[model samples]
Target: MRLSRAFIRAVSSPATVAWRSAQSRIFCSSPSDYRKSQPSMLKHLTSKIKATGPVSVAEYMREVLTNPVTGYYVRNNMLGPDGDFITSPEISQVFGELLGVWIISEWMAAGRPKQLQLVELGPGNGSLAADVLRVFGQLQSVLGGASVSLHLMEVSPALSDFQAQTLTGGGSQKADCEEDPVYRHGTTAAGLPVSWYRCLEDVPAGFSIFVAHEFFDSLPVHKFQRTEKGWREVLVDVDPEDSGKLRFVVSPGPTLASATLVQANERRDHIEVCAEGGVIIQQLARRILNDGGAVLIMDYGHDGTKTDTFRGFKDHQLHDVLLSPGSADLTADVDFSFLRRMAGGGVACLGPVTQGLFLKNMGIDTRMQVLLRNCHDPSTRKQLINSYDMLTNPTKMGERFLFFSLLHPSRLAAPTKPHGLKLEKRSPVLLPVAGFTDLSFS
Candidate 1:
């Protein structure tokens, strides 16, 4: 299944979107405010604040993004030239193709698991999945007769429909009961089975390659600001001046999240902590430790150096984060350091390398030249060149986007045998993780 994660679709805002070339909701109302008429969401948020005396920014984000009926992500078709932003896979096939190679590289490094599960979180329109599958089909010999299946975790019904159509070519079915772990099932154009789940907890256990692109950024982050009185969590409150609007306010004293989520020796005056993101990372680490697979994440992020990256996007232009509830995309730069810490010591964590270096390491240059040689049309060639530039240009998506990974500890160490009191292993030369190091290509 495929859709555009093409170049940034919005007319502006480059720093916030690299996978968006770099990277809304409409409420039903009058033509001018249709996208802004998130009546249910607005009323719910205000009422909750009125009752609880304001809510944490994390709580606010959770409602605005994943609130089932009217959450921004739940109701909108917000990708492509028609939506707020576009993606790399939509810009060019090379992006996903290289990712596909990385997946295979990891699989091979893991000794080619008998059953290969390709699980993608929040696969918008399935464009990345489709591109990866195309590569899988082309490299059939490399894959041998291994069993391969696709698993996608997504929430938007509209985007799921797009994913089904894109991946299955109209050949898919919905689960008979809502209680089923898999809500939908189908076979790809390549005849590989595909299943859909609502959450990561529901995905069937197996050796799986988990990939999340621009997913972590959407997870709710608890914002905190240090004060003379100590750390105070940021809360969203009903605007005193305008009941219809919302505003950022600080908690009076340390709350549960501020007490625990923030580090004791932290130096930053302000911080955005995604406890939910940490929980997800822990789950992934647990899975990798138990099932022997890998997790590859690509997104707009930093190595814990950034502070206050939360912002909104609507129709591609920057939107006020608290202006219209459920009417825009809200995201923050992922803190890879936070993820690494949460991954714990059970599995090996790899680079949060710049997207450009990662792609170049994965042989993007060679792949580009190969594609360019096979094409003759001037316009297509120009488009290909532009797409290549979009992905690799240091100023664009390249420098802004990052690739981070989690792998089984065994991936780094040779197989060991249990001795009387300890484990013993032979010194085997293992291939370095793809994209993280040039040794992968070498």
Candidate 2:
């Protein structure tokens, strides 16, 4: 729907209004101000919807999460305690250190490539990268510094600056000229200088170890619900009460459009389709297949065959994603099946293991024991115990979070299928729809 010039001006900043107006006059007659001014676009959408029909939840979500000016990721700082939620690296240095060890093991498994590209996608504040690098720095004899190149793929200029500071061991305000890890502004797969692209093709063809922690879940997801009539897609559109807000709206669109949304039992009420995540995984898989490498993905999600998992967070508190356009974090559960499929036929998929089990298997308990033995203060010991509990508790982040890995056939032996891959049946003693509401986009 077309938005009026006056309406755009009403919701846009003076500078934005002036720039957009100039662009409109010079490039096109239609006011494209809505591209930058989310409030205006939402307002326009809401007004049009009253006259039209209800918008689909997918359309609504696409607009609010990706709208250039007001979409969530485009306009907001979405990581860390101050933002929506704190990721593992942000929670403790130990997490990244252990990951570094995991990556090094994977590299060794790859026959220790003389020239290895260590790549990370959506590296927030670069904390994980820095921690990994620090750990690797100590194992220089095994890692041959000259042979390894660190590459980070990020988009936010603010985050890029933060990542640089974190990686260089400098104050947040200062830029380190000497400590540079090749930084790319966009997708490494795209052909933008082995640095910037919309996808992975941008990365130079080579053996690389990839890390994506708390990454995939953030990608936009298409929500679907099983109904007697068939499956319908959910959409996001402007909310009527708040001109600046966006809300989930269901649409009559067929679910077949989303490859991840396969036909399911008629009783299942919701499902999520992660087309973007699938595409990314497939691209990475193909790269690994062509060139020997491995990838590790860690995040909170279920490995079940059928379930709808969609939710939002803001300021460490659960918030209605529809409250504000581009202001809160919108996310959904990751489907490891899609990831495995994307790896084509040859790559090996591992885990879907509980974070608790993964960490314990990796010797977190031993690490904790060593730390406790070294510590003197009782308070410090208490703190460590508390943190350990929080990290290991099944009801908390421990059991709920999961870890999965993909490896090339030549690099590592195929992982034995994890025993915990099956979905647990909910006790009938609990409400029949107990878990059902938890998956709602609303």
Candidate 3:
């Protein structure tokens, strides 16, 4: 997008920079300041480290982001305009609408399965789910009145409450036991069955289309650095000089992860392995292979090309990751190459395609034009245009975010011909289906 003074001012804002930029640690305060500011979490971490020595970055992230009592995600409703960061779904209804269309499109290609469970991992505020559900309602006839249900995998009670309120209008009932597979249940405003789970494994197996937007990036990652001796795991340790804070330190010797996670042929001097993300991908792959469905993962990530992407965000500005505990959001860029490998050979993995290209292939431009044509309010129309720019502009979210998928192997195989019909050369699933193909749009 051409940068006007207004555009420059907007993108240069703390919120935008924090969400999209690659910045180094900005230590505005003492590393130990976290002890005074958020002592509950920081003290807990410092105490743990004092007792047990350095912890894995993965463990540190798990505690900081989802520590049940004091973690950021658990204690804060930190998303959207008024919070830590904003996501594409919050930027435009068109974002969610296009994805919703893709979900239904995939379902149709699967021959309208008897049961369709729309599963979302880390559904933030349920905005995406609401938009997808709306699209399903609009295409009821195309769905052939198929049994459709919404299954959400969320770990934050605060966010789940918000999601339940947003999607079901405060109608969901919490499960009696936290151990129950389904932790919550509700009927959407449109009367579709909706259920919530704390993990993907708890979601019942079915012909499900899994959607994860900006989800995998939050999974904890283990950082490693190569030394003359061998690869060593980088761990989070309480800085001896500043007992109130944390810092990264390399293991003195090889740790189990350093030995097991790093590939023998790996050439990078520095590497980060998200074993947790790999496990999730494996689960998704196994589900698609056995039960017949697909998985779509969208996030800001690298194709295993980036190193040292771990950082923190608070109120839309970069925060020193090591300085504070449980006071900001922590994340890293997902390594698509690792995920693809973990997916194994059974499922066909599609592009880690740029979000701009994927959405355009999914017909985002056409969708935008239609929305503009229907809306009459000047402010609303202008907002729609700006949102379009923000979402698709290459230098903005468009390039930073990407779309990747895992489909049942058969989805890409030659289509079986009906009784007397001729067999097409390309798989129907590859013909402009889900934007993985380069489809020409009018």
Instruction: List where candidate 1 sits over 4 angstroms from the true fold.
Output: 1-38, 414-432, 435-442
Candidate 3 lDDT (Cα, 0 to 1): 0.78
Q: 294-398 in candidate 1: lDDT tens per residue?
A: 998999999889889989989989877876778889999999999999888878888888888778877788778777888899999999999989998999998
Error of 2 at 377 (Å): 4.0
Per-candidate TM vs. native?
Answer: 0.86, 0.74, 0.88
Error of 1 at 21 (Å): 43
RMSD of each: 10.2, 12.5, 10.0
lDDT of 2 by residue, 88-110 (tens): 77766666766776676667656
| Each model's lDDT | 0.78, 0.59, 0.78
lDDT of 2 at 18: 15
lDDT of 3 by residue, 1-442 (tens): 1112243233212222111112112212334445466568888988877776677777788888999899888889999989989999999987887787677667766766889999999999999999888878876766776999999999999999999998998789998987898989999988999999998888998999999998988888888888777877777766666677677776666666676678899989888888778778888998999898888899989987888888888899988877667878999999999999988898989878888877787778777777787889999999999999999999998889988899887876633322221222332333324331221221
Distance from true location, Cα of 273 in model 3, Å: 0.6
- Our model 3 lands, by Cα RMSD against the true structure, at 10.0
